[model samples]
Target: MILEVAVIFLAVLWVVTIAMFMGHTKRQRTLATQQVEADSLRDQRIRELARRLENYQGGTIRMGEELHELRATVAPLPDKITILEQRDPSTLSFAQAARLVTMGASVDELTQSCGLTQAEAQLMTKMHGNG
Candidate 1:
C-alpha cells in the first residue's frame, strides 16, 4: 500500500541522517585530539629553547667575568716592563735578551738593546730565532 511505502522510506531517511551526524562528530573529536597534541609539542619546544638560551647567557656572563679578571691581572705588566727597561743596562738579564731574540730582534739590536756582547747576541739569535 502507498501509505506503508511512505512510512518505510521516512524511517530509512531518519536512520541515514543519524549515522552521518555520528560520523561527523567522531571526525571532530579526532581533530580536536590532534590539535591538543600539536599544542603540547609546541609548548615543550618553547621550554627547551628557553632553557638553552638561559645556559648560553650564563656562559657568556661567566666568560665576560673571566676576561675582566685576566685584564685586571695583566694591567701592571707593562709598567713593570717599562721600569725594568729604565734600570741600568747591566742589570738586564740573559733571559730578557733571549725574549728579545725570540721576538725577531737582530743580533745587533740585541747587543744594543740588552747590552749583550756580539757573541752572546749571535748565540741567542741562533738559539731562539725562527730560522
Candidate 2:
C-alpha cells in the first residue's frame, strides 16, 4: 500500500513539472514575438526619417543652384547702369539741374552750374521745385 502511494505521488509531481515547463516556454515565445514587433517599428521609423532627410537635401541643392543662376543673371547690371549713365551727358545734366532746383537753386544757378539753357533751366525748376 505504501509503495502504491509513493508511485502515485511521483506520477503527479512529474505531470505538474511538465505543465510548468510548457507554461514557461509559452511565455518566452510571447516575449520573443513582442521584441520582434518593437524592432520592426523602430526600423520603419528609421526608414521614414532617412527619406525625409534625403528630400530636404535635394531641396537644398536645388535652391543653391537657383541662387547661382540668379547671381549670374544680375552680375552685369552695375556695368550696364554705368554705361547708360556715361552714354547720356545731357541726361546727367538734366538730373543735376533737377536736384539743384529741388534744393532751392534758381534758374541762373541751374544754367551756370548744370550747363542748361535759360528756358530748360526754368522748365527744370518748375518741374522739380520742392513746393
Best by the TM-score measure: 1
Each model's backbone clash number: 0, 0
In Å, residue 131's CA in model 1 sits off its true spot by: 35
lDDT values, one for every candidate: 0.90, 0.88
lDDT digits (tens) for residues 6-75 of candidate 1: 9999999999999999999999999999999999999999999999999999999999999999999999
Q: Write candidate 2's Cα lDDT for 60-118 as tens digits.
A: 99999999999999999999989867764654467777878888999888788777789
Q: Number of clashing pairs, model 1?
A: 0
TM-score of candidate 2 relative to the true fold: 0.52
37 in model 1: Cα distance from truth in Å?
A: 1.5
Query: Over the full model, what C-alpha lDDT does candidate 2 score relative to the true structure?
Result: 0.88
Q: TM-score for every candidate vs. truth?
A: 0.58, 0.52
- Quote the lDDT for 91 in model 2: 46
